[model samples]
Target: MASLELRNVNKRYGQGQADTLKNINLSIDSGEFLILVGPSGCGKSTLMNCIAGLENISGGEILVEDQPISGMSPKDRDIAMVFQSYALYPTMSVRDNIAFGLKMRKVPQARIDEEVERVAKLLQIEHLLHRKPSQLSGGQQQRVAMGRALARRPKIYLFDEPLSNLDAKLRVEMRTEIKLMHQRLKTTTVYVTHDQIEAMTLGDKVAVMKDGIIQQFATPQEIYNSPANLFVASFIGSPPMNFIPLRLQRQGARWVAVLDSGQDRYELPLSVEDGQSLEGREVILGIRPEQITAANEGGPALRAEVQVVEPTGPDTLVFVSLNEVKVCCRLAPDAAPRAGESLALQFDPDRVLLFDANTGERLSKAPEHIPAGQSGNIAQFAAR
Candidate 1:
């Protein structure tokens, strides 16, 4: 396996056109799985194409194992890519398809046969080795495509939404299989997917991209728990982080956010230092749905009128209004209240996040620390 790095890489279609990939810098360690995740037209595919040498980078360097490869052709890059379309030849049997790459490199017929059988067994498709692409299911076709890549044993593997075409159940199955295969082979891999679940589950590191720029590059948990910007926070979660727009108010020495739910006002503590700059400034209170829950006995609570209740089997999402903004709270199915019911909701103050309303950037400083509460109001809120 080889380590791959992109240094200030830029891509553009025309001389004067805006770049499709802008000043990209990333490194994937050997035997590591890196996920490039973003929405459509976010340049993730373009970045993958650049790495695979299918698209020429407009500026900067692409390196494999610390050796520059920007000038090399795709075949010489020593990378194997599984396309979104599977791209298996319709007329070729699974064995031939898997062996095609080795054969092109002039590998002996016996070696090709052995490699084909090995990958077929590895992918659990040994029984379908003689079947053509047209005769197999979509999931089966995807495995064959993967087998083709595996047979070559390239320095790195590039998976471009390899599971996009599979059904939901099959996608989950294939995801597990891919993880297992990677665990056994320990090959360096770069995966591009629009699915956040796949991004969170499959990668050792994740790069969240948008409009040709990487917004955040970190571990999945870091990306989830401490997103760099509002866009990253809003994009990574399943139900999405709830953004409550409100103005900050200082209560003695602490900066607190006030929430109004039509019935009453609640003061949520902030971790930022005591400063006049944030006082009266508009900011978004960013909290995950899972972070909000039914108030524990005598714990901090906000009286909210439930507007909607959506039961999603294992958990129920409770929607309520705070500061005139709708907020979603994930609660245990058994404890979830119905619509129109008045419930006391509690938030985890330590887990609460703040973002600049206008800039969409996180407001707190790095290595955030929570200070002691300076007001009786905050204590009362915590007790209620």
Candidate 2:
């Protein structure tokens, strides 16, 4: 296991082109798992290649255990990487493919056999060892790729969407297995994926990347609950955060967001600090669907015309329009009302997020109060 650090890392494909990665900074402790997530072309994969020495950085440094490794070759980095493509030798048997890495490193024949057996069993691919890559299924081939990486005790392991090719059911099974293996091995790892569920469930720390930049690096909960900006807030959540754009007006001393559903207007209280900045200005009110609930229990209520109701097995998603933007409310399955019906929704003021609609930045200056375990020590990168 090893600690990894990236300081002001920057990558550019060419002088006239946009930089693939910009002023990137992150660190992870030994035995910790860090996930990198972003849309395609956002440079998440490029950042991974940089760390593995598959691609060189244009500026800054990458350090492993406080030793500079920016100039190291891929083989000298003491890291193992599993690519989205399995990259198995077509003619090699699964066992040979897994043993190839160890053989090149000149591991003793007995040790290589033992190591191959260890990873095969861990990945549950022991039965398919003698099969050629062409004879194995995609999922099995992925396991062989994982076995090849796990065969060596590298300082770090890098997984770039290794399960993206698997079916949903197999992907979930492999996810659980990966978690179990990580718990047992305690190897420092960096994973990149576009799946929100993977970003939330795996990883000790999650870095939400976009346009080649690390937007937010924190625990899964922080990225979900207290996103630093509108983009981070929308990207990390399923069904996405509800963005209701409206002008803020002062009602008595409190600032209120006027919500209109074509018939009536209801006001929702805004933070005092946020209210101060937007005396008569416009801003977006961001709330998660789960934050909105039935008002029968008593809270600030705003009546909206329900446009649609979608039942997602576990919960019912109610769609409504507020100031021309569609807002979703996650309601209990049994509490769902019919479409075209008006239902009063209760919102928690403290849970409401206010963002500058034009800039897509959080308007409230309040320091994000990340709940404990929210970051999982991702900030420790700065210390290293």
Candidate 3:
């Protein structure tokens, strides 16, 4: 395994056309699992291709183990990639396919046999060694692609959405398998995906990219709790954060956000630090759906009629209208209210985030760094 570094990397197809990848800089330690995630046309695949030498950068350098590899050819770079298409030889048996790379490298027959056996057992595809790619399932084909790469024992492994074509259940299973494989092999890896679940669960560090630029580079937890901008916040979460547009007001000495539910007006006390006076300034209050609860706490509660309720196995999603906006609240299945019923919703003031309405930049101070694997903040909204 080797560390991978990219400095000021830029990519462009032509002189007049726009740059495909902006000045991108990133560092990955040896044996790490780094994920590059974003929507389509975000330049994630371009960056991956650059690292593997399939596409040369217009500027900057790519290094492996502190040595420059930017000028090297794809074969000389020694990076193995598992493509989404599972580009396997249809006529070649699984064993032959796995051994093909070693054959190209002219490794000893005995060593190639041993590597083939090892990765087959590692990927649990030993029984299909004699079968051709046409007889194998999609997941099996993907495993063979990965096995072929593993047999190379390169400095880095690049996975370009290797599971994108699989079914939902198969994708989850393959995700677990990949994570376990990484743990056992401990190979330095660069994975590119558009799946949020994969981005959050599989990577040790995640880089959220958009429009040919890196938006945020940090741990999954850090990106979740303290997003640098509104785009990062809106992109990473599953249900997504709710952006409530309102202006802050100073109720005497403290800053408060006034919420109107068409029936009652509730003043939400906010914590403003660094002497940042936000009175009479319009901003977006960004909070997760899970942050808003049905529990009636005394701090400040808004009375709103439940517009809809959806039971989703472990949790219930209840919808309500606040300030002419539809708000969703995730609550316990047993505590959920039916449609048209009045419910007192409470907000966690400290956990609430703020963003600039016009610029989409984070305006409120981010919460303290949440330790990995720890639950988020406890609400100060006490029951009356």
Candidate 4:
């Protein structure tokens, strides 16, 4: 196991050109899993390649266990990478594939055989060891690729969208398998993916990237509940956070947000202590679909016509027009109203978030955290 760190890392293609990576800084503790996630063209893969020594950094250092490795060749860096394509030699049996790396380093054949068996059993692929890559299922082949990397038993393991090519069901399965494998091996790992689900479920720390800049780097829970910027808030959720443009209104001693549905209006109370800075300003109010529910306690309620209803098994999504924008409300499937039906929606004030209108930076402070396994809704959506 090893710790990884990048200090003021910078990458550029040529002189006078925009940097591919800009002042990137991150640290991962030994045996921790770190996921780098963002949309395509977000420099996640570029950053991963840089860490793997496939691309040299323009400035700064890459360290493994506190030792600088910026000038080391990929082979010398003691990192094993599992590529997205599951790069297996077509003619080699799974056993040979798993042992190829050890053989290249001239580990004795007996030792190579022992190492191959260890990872094959570890990956639960012993039954398929004699099969060629062409004979195994996508998930099985992915295991072989993983076994290859695991055989090296390097200081750090790098996975670049290793599950991207699998079917949705298989992808979910592989995700669990990978998580279990990490738990067992306890090796330092760096994973790059565009999938938010993977980022939320797999990482001890997640770095959300955009335009070659890291938007936020924190635990999955922190990123979900207290994203540093609007992009991070918008990127890490499943149903995505709901954004409504609003002008803050002062109701004497308190600040509030005006939410209008054209049918009815709601003055959702704000938790701002610095109301003087926000009063009457056009900032964005971000509420998660789950936080807006069927009115019950009558705290902050609004009446809106249901524009659309979508049933997604576990919960139904109810859509309505609010403040001239479409807003989604997550509801129990049995509780959802039909389209065109009038629905009374309620807001959870403590869970609401505010963002600066122009800068897209978070304006609200992170809310107090409830202990884990207490609050179930991720729709609290960047409240912190």
Candidate 5:
């Protein structure tokens, strides 16, 4: 395995002034699994192509183990890529397809056979070894494509949505298989996907991208817990994080967020430290659905009219209006209230986040009135 580095990498299709990859910089340790995640049209595939040596970077360098390989041909880069489309050779059998790379490298016949057999078993395609690509299903074809790459122990592996075409159930199974395979091989890899769940579950490190720029790069836990900015907060979570616009006003020696659900009005306290910076201003209050819960002993509760309740088997999601913005609350399935019913929602003030309404940037200063653990003044930090 080898470490991969991209220093200020850039790629532009034409002189139209728009860059597909803009001054991208990242470093992947040897044997690390990194995931690239973003919305469609965000230039993820273009970046992957550049790394594969298929699309030459307009500027900057690509390095493998501290050696510059930007000018190297794909054949000399010693990297294997499995694309979304299973670009298999239709004329070759599964065994031959897996052996093609070894054949090109002129490996001894016996060794090629041994390598193909090993990958076939690893990929669970040993039974289909003699069948041609034309006879296999889409999933089978994709496995063959993987086998073709895995048959050789390359410096790194690149997978571009390799499980995207499979059905939901199959996708989950393959995802587990891929993780297990990575753990066993300890190979350096970079994978791209649009699925948030896949991004959270598969990657040891994730880079959230948008408009050709990386928003944040960190471990899955850090990305989910301490997002650098609003974009990172909204992009990495399932059902997404909730943003509620509120008016911040100084009440006594503290600043409080006045929340009106059209049914009830409540002042959620903020720490004097956090509220000190926003004496009288409007800001966006961010929170996750899971942070809001049904009433527990000694918890702060706010009343709201439930607009809808969705039970997703594992848990229940309740949607309601807060200060004219739709806010979600995740509750235990048994505790969910029906639509049109008024429910008292509980929130831990320390878990609330404050952001600039216009710029959507997080506020660094916390309020002082609110205690370290809970709040009765103004809601303070929003746990990612």
Candidate 6:
């Protein structure tokens, strides 16, 4: 396995047109699973194609194990790629398909047979070795495609949305199988997917891309908990983070956010200290749905009428309005109340995030201040 690096990479279609990728820089250690994820037309596939040498980069270097490989052909890069379409030959049996690359390399027939058996067992497709691609299911065909790459034992593997074509159930199963296989093989991999779940779960490190530039490159937990920008925060979560438009107010040494529920106003303490500069400045308050919950005694709460309730089996999503902005709160199914019922909602102030409304950038860190009548670690304020 080899560490992969992209340095100052830039791609442009024509002389006068804008660049597709701009000064992209990323690196992954050997045996790391790196996921590139973004919306459609975001240049994710183009980046993958460049790394595979299918599309030549207009500038910068692509390196493997610290050796430049930008000028090398795809066939000479010691990399294997699996496409979303499975790309299996209809006439070839699974065994033959897996052995085709070895054959092209003039490996011995005996060695090819051994390699095919090993990959089939690794993929749990030993029983389907003799079946032609036309005779197998989509999931099986995908495994065969993966087996073809695994048989080669290449330095790096590129998977471009390999599970997108499968049904939901099969996709989930295949995801687990792929993770297990990666754990066992420990191959250096770069995967491209539009699915946030796949990006978060499969990658040891994730690169959230947009407009051909990497927005943030970090571990799944960091990307989810501490996003670098509003775009990254909105793109990576399931229900996505809730954005409430509010203005900052100076409350002594620290800042506070005022939330009005049409009847009462609640002062939500903020950790930021430079509130004097931000007073009267519009900002966005970001908190995940899971971070908001039914109010508990002796803690901060917001009084609002339930607008809607959706039970998703695992959890209940309750909708409420604060500061005229519709907000979603994740709660236990039993805790959710009917629409029109007034509820008191609590927030984890320590977990709350603030963003600049104009630029969508996160605010700089400041020391947290505990509200009156609350412990140093917890801020307690309620609205009714």
Candidate achieving higher lDDT, 1 or 5: 1
In candidate 5, what are the lDDT values of residues 267-308, reduced to their tens digit? 887653642467556787878899888877666678899999
Error of 6 at 46 (Å): 0.7
Off by over 4 Å in 3: 297-299, 364-384
Top-lDDT candidate index: 4
TM-score of 1: 0.94
lDDT of 4 by residue, 157-264 (tens): 999999999999999999999999899889899999999999999999998888888888788998898776678889989799999988988888788898899999
TM-score of each: 0.94, 0.93, 0.93, 0.94, 0.91, 0.93
Give candidate 6 regions above 4 Å deviation.
273-276, 367-384
Model 2, residue 181: distance off in Å is 1.4
| Count of clashes, each model | 0, 0, 0, 1, 24, 0
Off by over 4 Å in 1: 366-384
lDDT of 6 at 358: 81
lDDT, each prediction: 0.88, 0.86, 0.87, 0.88, 0.84, 0.87
Candidate 2 similarity to native, TM-score: 0.93
Error of 5 at 106 (Å): 1.6
Query: Residue 63: error of model 1 in Å?
Result: 0.7
Decoy 4 TM-score against native: 0.94
Compare candidates 5 and 6 on lDDT and give the better one: 6
User: Candidate 6's error at 349, in angstroms?
Assistant: 1.0
- Candidate 5: segments with Cα more than 4 A from true spot: 251-254, 271-276, 365-384
Q: Sort by lDDT, best first: what order? A: 4, 1, 6, 3, 2, 5
After superposing candidate 2, which stretches have Cα over 4 Å from the reference? 274-276, 297-299, 365-384
